[model samples]
Target: MLVILVALLWFTTVEASHCSIMARLSLMRNISELSQNNYGRPDLSHTTIVGSVLHGIKEIEVWLQNFAPGSSTPIHRHSCEEVFVIVKGQGTLYLTPSSHSKYPGNPQEFHIFPNSTFYVPVNDAHQVYSLP
Candidate 1:
């Protein structure tokens, strides 16, 4: 009788552990599905990211952004080359040539849509604005 009782208790404990693991796996799957479906969610811009320096050879990051009409970035130069992938709306890019300073040329407006990207060379001074 004592041996039979011990065996039943052991079986129940093992089954409970398996149930808990399965529950955790189901939660993880749901999170992954939500991320895939909501890649362009508006809420993404509200989250702030603290800056940190990376020590490795390569680093990658993804960001979602929304620019209000007439919004602009200050003229700045980048030490590293930069790329901007437009996910929506129309905007303007101000690119300066080597011979000119103080925003060099007239603003170039681009009608960029989803799935488009542009690259700027290093040391290029530029500013960007969204048309109202």
Candidate 2:
């Protein structure tokens, strides 16, 4: 009985490992193919970063959004951390904590310029606006 139980567990573990390996291979293949495809179009407003995501890693979505004189992203939360970098004009970030705070729902503003990168923690609701 001991031998049989051990054999079953061993086979299950081996099979699971094999499956994971195969999944990783497939993901790598897909990411490679997508990288070869045309990701977006050129525009004066903003451009998208081509192939921003890698297969098997879905924690974050990367984009290069160009705002007109005034543009912004919607307020929302991510399952994982979200990050942004300013590749162009000046912008402002507005953040409000989802919990109680000493400021009591006051908004904090960050002035961002070209080549600045910022990270927002997961589950924090926030918004962004571009300035002329």
Candidate 3:
């Protein structure tokens, strides 16, 4: 199983005219203590730490994702970049850079370990799988 800390920043044309001067702090808790959901994917669950749903932060979303052995996220893409900070366990990232292509091409595989960090470019197809 693997536990990954994902920090996703959304780019938008709308700018924050007034930034909050007040700072916010989030206390880290046990993964089981935080609210989590699979979003319909089996063996994979995620807890949102900072995002529009919780902290009302419009520009960024932080999540803690847990994957059981042999589990993976669906092949997906987003308009905004997605970054991952590996906290524990090992996994493989399948990435296909197809920003301009009509269909996704072959994917490049990358191995990830603890303490490593990686980012997915905007609109690229990617999937993450946890090794048993």
Candidate 4:
């Protein structure tokens, strides 16, 4: 059986002008129901839940990600701090805190289960793998 791992990603960085005074609501949809994009990685697929393109959210961007069993994301780093909320299944996070160094050193592994949360510092290289 394929264990689908669902996660919500909060990206902290947005333009102020895109902020809105009125409140907005975005309903969460099923993983298979929502549009999924691999983002250049075959093992990972993600859909934007809230952001400038969808809700004009200026403070943060929200995304829903689904990972197939035995799949893993590529080692990557970003400018903004990222937080992940795991809703189902389990995974392992490999993080390398080398924001100030020229090369990413050995990574530290952390196991993540359902209902758990993890944070990644800005520019820290990291990868997540779905456990079967």
Ranking by lDDT: 3, 4, 2, 1
Clashes of each: 0, 1, 0, 0
For model 3, how does the per-residue alpha-carbon lDDT over 27-89 read when each residue is reduced to its tens digit? 454656778889888798789876553454678888999999999888899888899999999
Error of 1 at 53 (Å): 4.5
Error at 62, model 1, angstroms: 3.8
Please provide, for model 1 over 10-122, each residue's C-alpha lDDT reduced to its tens digit, 9 standing for 90 to 100.
Answer: 11212234344445443222312322222354322321111111111123323334556666556887555566766566667777655145555654455544555676566
Model 2, span 23-59: residue lDDT tens:
6555323322332222342222332232213222322
Q: By lDDT, is 2 or 3 better?
A: 3
List the candidates' TM-scores in order.
Answer: 0.48, 0.53, 0.78, 0.70
Once fitted onto the true fold, the runs of candidate 3 whose alpha carbons sit more than 4 angstroms away are 11-32, 40-42
lDDT of 4: 0.70
Candidate 4 lDDT tens digits, 1-132: 113333334443544343452234344546356666777877676777655545555556667777888887788887777888887888899999976698767899998888888888888989988986
What value does the lDDT take at residue 106 in candidate 4?
Answer: 87
TM-score (C-alpha, index-matched) for candidate 4: 0.70
**Minimal lDDT window, size 10, model 1:** 1-10
> What TM-score does candidate 3 get on C-alpha atoms?
0.78
Candidate of highest lDDT: 3
Candidate 1 has an lDDT of 0.44
